[model samples]
Target chain A: MNFFLGIKIFFRSLFLQSVWNYERMQNVGFVFSLIPFINHLYKDKTVRAQKIKTHFGFFNTHPYLANLLLGIVMRLEEKCLKNEVSQEEVLRTKTMLAGPIAAIGDRFIWSTWRVVCSFIGVAYYLCSGKEGVWYQANIFVGILLFLLIYNLLGHLPLRILSIYWGYKYTNNVVDKISKFALQSYIVKIRNVGIIILLFASFIYSISLISDLKIVLLFWLNILLSLLLSKKIAEVGIFYILFLLNIIILTVTNL
Target chain B: MKLSLWFLFISTIAGLFHLDVMVFGQFMFSRPIVVAPIIGILSGLPEVGLIVGIITELLYVSIIPVGIKIPPDSTTVAVLTVVCSERLIDIPVALFFAIIFGFLYKYIDIAQRSFNSLLLGWVDTAKAELVEQRVNLLIIYALFITYLKTVLFYLIVLPILSFFIKQVFCCWIKNLWVHMDLYNLIYILPAIGIGIGLAHFVEE
Candidate 1:
C-alpha cells in the first residue's frame, strides 16, 4: 500500500503536475526531497499528498541546483503554506526568492564551488592516479561536499530569514550575498587575465598537427563567430567544418 | 527497460558537463538529455554517445520551453546516430551521416506525436468508462508506449542500417578527415571570438 502511494506520488509529480501545469522539472526536485519521508508515511494518503504538495512548491530549481533550492524551498514552503498568507503573497514570496536564490546558488555553488571541487578532483586524479578506491572516494566525496554545503547554505537561510522578516526579506539577503561575492576583488582584473590565458593556450594546443590549413580554420572560426555575435542564429560553422574536413581528408589522403 | 537504462546513462553523461552551463547544474535528467544519451550508449561507442550529446546540446542550447515551441526531439538524434554508426560500417565517415541521423530523429518525434494522439483518445475513453480500472490501464499504456518508442527505435533501425552499410558501401576516395587537433581548434576559436566580441563591441 505504501509502495503504491509512493508510486502514485512519483507519477503525479512527474506526469500530472509536470505535464499539465508545465512545471514538471520543479516537481521532480520536490518529489526527490519527499522521497525519504514517503517511505515512512505508508498508510496516510491524505497527509502524504498534503506534505508532498507543500514541498512541491519549491520546485523551479535547475537539476544541479536542485539540492540547494530543494533545501531552501522545503523549509520556506512549509512556513508559507501553513500561514494564512494569500495566494498572491505565497507566489510573491516564491518569485522574489527564486531569482535571488538562483543567482547565489548558481554563482557560489554551481559556478565557483563546482569549479574548485572539479579542479581538486582532477588534480587528485592526476597526482594519485585514477584507479584506486581512494580516488573514487575522493571524487564521490567532492561531489557530495558540493551537494551538502550548497544545499545547506541554500536551504538554511530561509529558516532564519523567513522567521525574522518574512519571505520577501530572504530575497534581499540572498541578493546582498550574491552582490558581495560577485564584487569581490578576485573577480576583477585577474580573472580576466586567467580567462585570456586559458583561451590562448587552448587555441595554440589545437593548432598542432592539424592538416586543414590552420589559417583557414582560423578565418572560418572568426567569420562564424562574427555571425553568431550579430545574432544570425543558424548552423553555419559546424557544417562548414564538416565540408572542410571532407575536402582536407580527400586532398591529404588522411 | 533496456532502452530506458540506455537513455539514462547516455543522457546523464552528456548533460553532466553542458547542463552545468545554463541551469548551472539544474535539470540534468530532463527529457532531451535523458533520451539523447540513451540512443548512443545502447548501440554505439561512448564517442558516438558524446558526439550526439554535444550536437543535440548545441542545437537545443537557445531553445527554452519558456512558451510554446516544443523543442526538437533530441533523443531521436542519439537513437539515429547510434543506429547509423553501427549499421553504416564506418567510424570516421562524413559528419553528413550525423546530419542524416539527426533528421531521422526528428521524424521519429513525429511518430511519437501520433502515438500521443492515440493515447489521448484512450484517455477520453477511459474517462467515459467511469471505471477506475480504465484510468490505471490508460496510465500503464502511456508508460508502455514511452518505453516502446525508445526500444523500437534502436532494435528496428540499427539492424537494417548495419546490414546496408556493411554490404553496399565502398571505401573509395576517403581523405578529407579533420584531425582532432583541428577539431579542437575549430571549437575554441569561437570562444575566443566571443570573448573578443563581447569585450570589444558589446558594452556591459
Candidate 2:
C-alpha cells in the first residue's frame, strides 16, 4: 500500500540523513518531533544520541553558517549514501566538514535570515489589512523559504570546499569566513553603534504602538531601567511592561 | 493496527489534560506530515485536526530537544488540543493550548531528571556485578528505565483523563480560556524577523 511506500521514503530520508547526519538519531528525534505519531520508533539511546548531536550542532557555528553547513551535509549525505561510499571516509569527511558548515550556517542562515524574516512578519502583523490565515501562512512560508533556499545553496560551496581542499582546505575556508564575519559585524558596529541602532529601532517600533497611554507606560520603562539598573533582570522588563499596561488600564477611563 | 488506536486514544487523552503519560510518552511519533493525518482520521475530525497539527508542528519547528532539557512537547498538546477544539469548540483555542503546553513542559523535564536518577541507581547496582555482566546490565537497565517510566505513566493516566474530559467536564474547562485575546499576535512575526536579522547580523 501507499503507507509502505511512505515508510520507505522516510527510511531513505533517514539514510540520506546519515551521510551528513553526523548528529545521528537526534535529527531523527527533531524530524519525528514535527510529526505526531512516530516519535516512539526512534526511542533507543543510539537514535537519541545521534539526533541530539545534530540538534545541538548549532552551537558550533554562526547561525547562518550552521544552516548552510547542514544543507550541504544533507546533500552530501544523500549522494554519498547512493554511491555507497565507505563508512570510514564518510566519518572522516563528516568530522572535517561539520565544523566549517556549522560556522557558515550559523552566520548566514541563523543570524541573518532569521532576523530579516522575523522583522517582516512583525511588520505585517503590526499593520492593518494583514490579519488573517493568508497572512499567517505567508509568514510561515517566508521562514520556510529562507531555511530551504539558503540551506540548499550553502551546500554547493561546501561540496567544493570538502571535495577540492579536503579537510584542511575546508578548515581554512571556515577560519577565513569566521574572521571576516566577526570583524565586519562586531568591529564595525562596536558598542556605541549597536546602542544607537537599538535606540533608533526602539523609537520606530514605539511609534507603531499608537496608544498614547501605552507609549507613556513604556516611556516610564526608561526611568524604571535606570532605577533598577543594579538588580534588574532582563526578564523583569517584560513583567514591568505587563504590569504597567494593567495599571494604565485600571487608571484610565479609556 | 488495533494497538495504533490504543496509542491514539491514550495519547489524545493524556495530551488533552496535559497529564504526564506512561509508556507511550513519545508523542513526537505522531507528528509526521503523513502519519499525523492518518492518525487524525482514526480519531475523527480528520481534516481540521491534521491541518491544526501541522500548524502546531511548524510553529515549533526549530525547537529540538537536547541533553536533559526537554522543549515543550507539542505532540500531545497539538493532537489533543486540535481534537478538543474542533469537536467541542474552535481553532483559535489551540493557540492558548500551545501556551499552556509550554508551561507543562517543565514538569516533563522533572520527569526526565527522575528517570536519570533511576538510571544512576541502576549503574550503582551494575558496579557490584561481574565486569562483563555489569556492562550488559548497565545498558539494559538504563534503556529499560528510560522506556518503562514513560510508557507506564501514559497507560495509567491517559484513560482516566479521557473519561474526565468526555464525561465529567464536557469540555467545560475550555470555557475558562475563552476570554483570552488574540490581539498583537502579528507582533510575533516581526519579533521573529528581528531575531533572524540579529542572528544573521551577528554571524557575518
For lDDT, the strongest prediction is 1
Model 2: residues >4 Å from true position, as ranges?
A: A1-112, A128-171, A176-211, A214-240, B1-204
Model 1 off-target regions past 4 Å? A1-25, A28-61, A66-69, A76-88, A99-173, A183-207, A210-219, A222-229, A232-236, A244-254, B1-94, B99-149, B160-204
Which prediction has the highest DockQ against the true structure?
1
* Model 1: per-residue Cα lDDT at residue B29: 35
Q: Which ten residues in a row are the worst by lDDT in model 1 chain A?
A: A12-21
C-alpha lDDT score of every prediction, in listed order = 0.39, 0.38
For candidate 1, write residues A49-114 as lDDT tens digits.
444444444345323333333333333544555664544554465556655555544444434433
Candidate 2 docking DockQ: 0.07
Q: Write the per-residue lDDT of candidate 2 for residues A1-254, one digit (tens) a residue.
A: 13343343232222121111222212321222212112222445444334323332212222123233333333344444467664345445545655556544444433333333323322332322222322233333433443343334443344333323322233255555556655445344333323432453364346546555444443454345434433543223334534444444444633
- As for model 1, its CA RMSD to the true structure in angstroms is 9.5
* Top TM-score hit: 1
Give the per-residue Cα lDDT of candidate 1 at A142: 30
